[model samples]
Target: MGTLGRSGIVRKPNETMRMLVTTIIGVVFGFFIGVSFPTISLTKFNFPSNLIPSLNFTYMDNAWSSVTGHRQVNSLSGVPKMWVETNPRGAERLPPGIVTPDTDLYLRRLWGKPSEDLIIRPKYLVTFTVGLNQKTNIDSAVRKLSENFQVLLFHYDGRTSEWDEFEWSKRAIHVSVRKQTKWWYAKRFLHPDIVAPYDYIFIWDEDLGVDNFDAEEYIKLVRKHGLEISQPGLEPNSGLTWQMTKKRDDTEVHKETEERPGWCSDPHVPPCAAFVEIMAPVFSRDAWRCVWHMIQNDLVHGWGLDFALRKCVDPAHEKIGVVDAQSIVHQTVPSLGNQVSRGITLV
Candidate 1:
């Protein structure tokens, strides 16, 4: 009877332990099935329908809201519609219909203009990068550009004060940063949205001699020919690299021309046809918007950009040309390339 009683006690505990283990295994298996096949309705598991609503099935949505502090609205199909976040600090927001100032305040301060005053909007905008040593060349170019275009100067030498020596400098918006390439400055400063008001944009090197180039005449020819990407014809003896860019007396603008030995033979190809060297290229505001996107942030010198300029304008041959009517001499100065810092060329 004592042995029978001991056996009964052990059997009762073993049955209880088996039941407990079965319950845990059932719960783990259900959880895994629920995760693995989300399409299965919770109601199929005999769970109370009301319990499903109380539990968060959209954990991702809840987590996203918690981290961003933004409430997300989901469609009946469970797709997110929009995310809305409210500023808890209660800072005043700008009222509707107020104009946000787009002009760079640092550039304005350099121009010695009041912060409240609006910048003078010009029909044409010209930009160039210069060193302190190239003041003479810049002075000539700025003088020509200032006649019809609002000039913006990017001084690589960082000598903003030295520009005071030139009379035309007073008319320009000057920004100076030391030892950076023209493309580097251009990427940061010449955002298309900011300069959208201008009809044309001329981005040129400071070394170009603009004695023969007329800013007014150049615009007239560009508008006449509908040239979206163009440059002044380089004089035949002015270190002529491309035959297409060299001046031709027969026409005002040439779209296709004979290329040098290394240039592409196909008239449709660039750096041979529909190409202007980046040294002194003019862009229509629309073309500038597209070209600005092509300028890589790390490619400061813009070495191979000429080949890609055709991508910005369709029928590039028709829209891109050399304006021989307003030719300019490329002095080809190595001013920017000579600046070496820590055995690396900055230009």
Candidate 2:
């Protein structure tokens, strides 16, 4: 695993990956602690004399990153080499393999230009939690998004290869696990650093109908209105629980929609104002960084998150709303609950 930057540079493994390096650092540091006030300087760094004022922790952190960030471990000639972990430990452990939290979906060629040549960073990310039955819906939705958006599908039904029929499928990312919610997959795989390249992120359910939605146009409205957290207004339907998300056909967006009796004590509060259902919410890059941290591992998808999304942005009421000009039909498919009933449990 190499550390990748937007510049398309994939750091080669740390060349000085010898146990002697570890042993030397450990021994030198131990000697410093042994002494009452050990001061070493750059002039006498080889043996550690009483000249250095203090340790440069920044240098040490870089060293640690070099040692742990990549798979390369023992280099006899102090020359960095490319390596791949084909037989991985899988998810039995906390991180399976590698300490780095960032990753991408670019397929690598065995022998060609440097891996950096493969970086085609997209400006946005649109993720869907899907099952086999929702293929038609997801395919249609993905087609509506421009090439600037990266497509990531979380396969809860464990069916991924079937999506290869689409030409775009060759470029998208797919993560398949038997039965899990999109929130779970987001927390685990969509680390902020991994998706930092994108300007916006769409974490949506697979049952959305994008027939009238244009991802690029939706983004334009989100930016034009200075919205940090937003969603496409829901097409008129009986399944809606909040009028705040319903499409207002005459407007570009609706920040404050009238709620039913006693549903919202304050018109500016959640479930009435600053509200967009979790089913199809779009978050700015900075907003998602904060929202991702707020997600609890135990939270079942879409149960109570729609209200708290306002916390991620400044001026919540002004920045959170529904874009009516670009909207989608929520199919109200039973994905999480149906999968859980088969085997998984809430408790």
For each candidate, the alpha-carbon lDDT, in order, equals 0.78, 0.78
lDDT string for model 1 (1-347, tens) is 21235456534566777888999999999999877664332223545657765765466456656665554455678654444344323321322234343443223444454754545546888888988888887887777764557888898888888888877777678888888878898899898877887888888888898788889989999999999999999987679477778888989998887666656768678766898998899999899999999888897788889888999999898999999999988888875776787888764
Once model 2 is optimally superposed onto the true structure by TM-score, how far is the C-alpha of residue 278 displaced, in angstroms? 0.8
The true-versus-predicted C-alpha distance at residue 167 of model 1, in Å, is 3.0
Residue 327, model 2: lDDT of 85
- Give the per-residue lDDT digits (tens) of candidate 2, residues 1-347: 87676898776557335555898999999887767332222222354536655767436534544554433332577543333333334422333355454565445767867757566657888899888887888888888988788889999878888999999887888999877888999998888877887789999988888889988899999999999999998887627457899888899988987777888888888878888898888999899999999999876665888888888887888999999999888878777545655565532
> Model 1 lDDT vs. the true structure?
0.78
For each candidate in turn, give its C-alpha RMSD to the true structure in angstroms: 15.8, 17.2
| TM-scores of all predicted structures | 0.68, 0.69
Number of colliding residue pairs in each model: 0, 2
Q: Which ten residues in a row have the lowest lDDT in candidate 2?
A: 36-45
Off by over 4 Å in 2: 1-107, 114-120, 337-347
